[model samples]
Target: MSYDPRRPGEDKSQRAQTRERDDAQVEKAHRPDALILHEIIRREGEEEMRRTALALSLSGFSAGLTMGFSLIVPGVLKGHLPHEPWADLIVSMGYSIGFLIVVLGRQQLFTENTVTPILPLLTERTSGAFLRVVRLWSIVLVANIVATIVIASVLAHTDAFKPEVREAFAEISRHTIEDPFWTTVIKAVFAGWLIALMVWILPATGSAAPFIIILMTWLVSMCGLAHIVAGSVDAYYLVATGEIDLAKYVTGFFVPTLLGNVVGGVTLVSVLNFGQVAPDMEGQDRVGV
Candidate 1:
């Protein structure tokens, strides 16, 4: 008979302990293979992109209407701070209200999600995925802009808003129009970057996400950075009141801002995320392993 590996009447506790240690060591040495991280990011990007597009379309419309508060609040506050120029800044803080709601509540806001969903398509061979992502983005973005224009126009024409408040809205629009197209793009890029940063950081913070969002957006607004969706509120108001022509608003502000925002989110945040995980994945053979 072969020699027994275990002694009769022995507790076998040491053997159990040795086996556990071996298992623990194996687990500790196991690193995630590169392809897994790539696939995960890819799937996350595509799914998020599609879902985010829909969410953004709806959220953008709401943001458009809600962002009207940005225009209204500053002017409203200005009335109270009647004597101080700094009051203008104070009221702008109110503009962040809609953003905080949309971001924290998990509604897609367009610009931020632009970066996240494109990565998979960029790296994958999935058929129609790229087209679908683009199609969704185009649909949602156009709808959002149109909704903002219509809503802002209606509000501007009606007595629903007080005269000074309307004037403030118009004033904001005029200021935007005064900027060069390139300048607007630059501002939008900065805004998009900040928004993406907010998104990336929020996921890491469980309970304090809301506070982070509020703080980042407040800074975005206070810095006068232009956001494509949010800026549409001001732009639409301008177009609605005939203060700026439709062509100029579209070409000058909307298009450039959209491009800038895309660049900021995709080129900056998404790439950074990809880079962070790339180094840890080298030399791992792409096996079913």
Candidate 2:
């Protein structure tokens, strides 16, 4: 959640003046290479693993509740915009709002954990490490989904939003279930890939972290890709509104998207990113991951 939280912040000018003029120092000042990025995330994963179950669950819940903004913002956009191709494109950009909040706030998002924890699990390759990853995944995913379900119910039943906004929410939620099972699965693959990639690059983004989050998340929405957490808010809203049955929501959206996201995140991003960094990472300090 932090870029070495124990370390104090240093001014860019102060670091440039104080550090020796060397290649290593130069690398430190600029973008971190893939290996450095891996270590940074791996340490983050280690720190996450050390968190108590309650802390992880609460953070995950907060992320899920906040993720509702992605749906609400886009719905608000749609309510204001005339229905047109270009308008949809502009509305998709609003989908980044929730992601900006979650990522910037350092909340426990399930998609992010797909890559962050796996680096250490790959290096250790021990039963304990594998169990730890599973534990984190289970806790975070459940907490996120439950929170989404609760928020969806609140949106569906309450008069908290304008009628136009609520209608827009229902209209957008329908698209998530309109896709066939395999089609949704395929779309979710790209969603998972991009999200994990966002986490991977974040450690190197310096002050551009917010821009990167918005850009990558916008790509997902613009491409109509499925994301487990973000899409859940939409899908669950339909179920709560009685527009779709629970069985259809689960079979059509939940199952396919979940499988696709896990496959895309763990296989495409986590395994491959670690594979590229493995040779350089060998025999290095364990760093207690």
After superposing candidate 1 on the true structure, give the runs of residues whose Cα lies further than 4 Å from its correct spot: 1-44, 49-60, 122-127, 281-289
Provide TM-scores for the models. Answer: 0.76, 0.89
lDDT of 1 by residue, 36-142 (tens): 54555466567766565566577557655665565666656654567567776677677777777766555556775665566665555376877776766676677
Task: lDDT for model 2, please.
Answer: 0.90
Off by over 4 Å in 2: 1-25, 283-289
Locate the minimum summed-lDDT window of 10 residues in model 2.
1-10
Lowest summed lDDT window (length 10), candidate 1: 280-289
Each candidate structure's count of clashing pairs: 0, 0
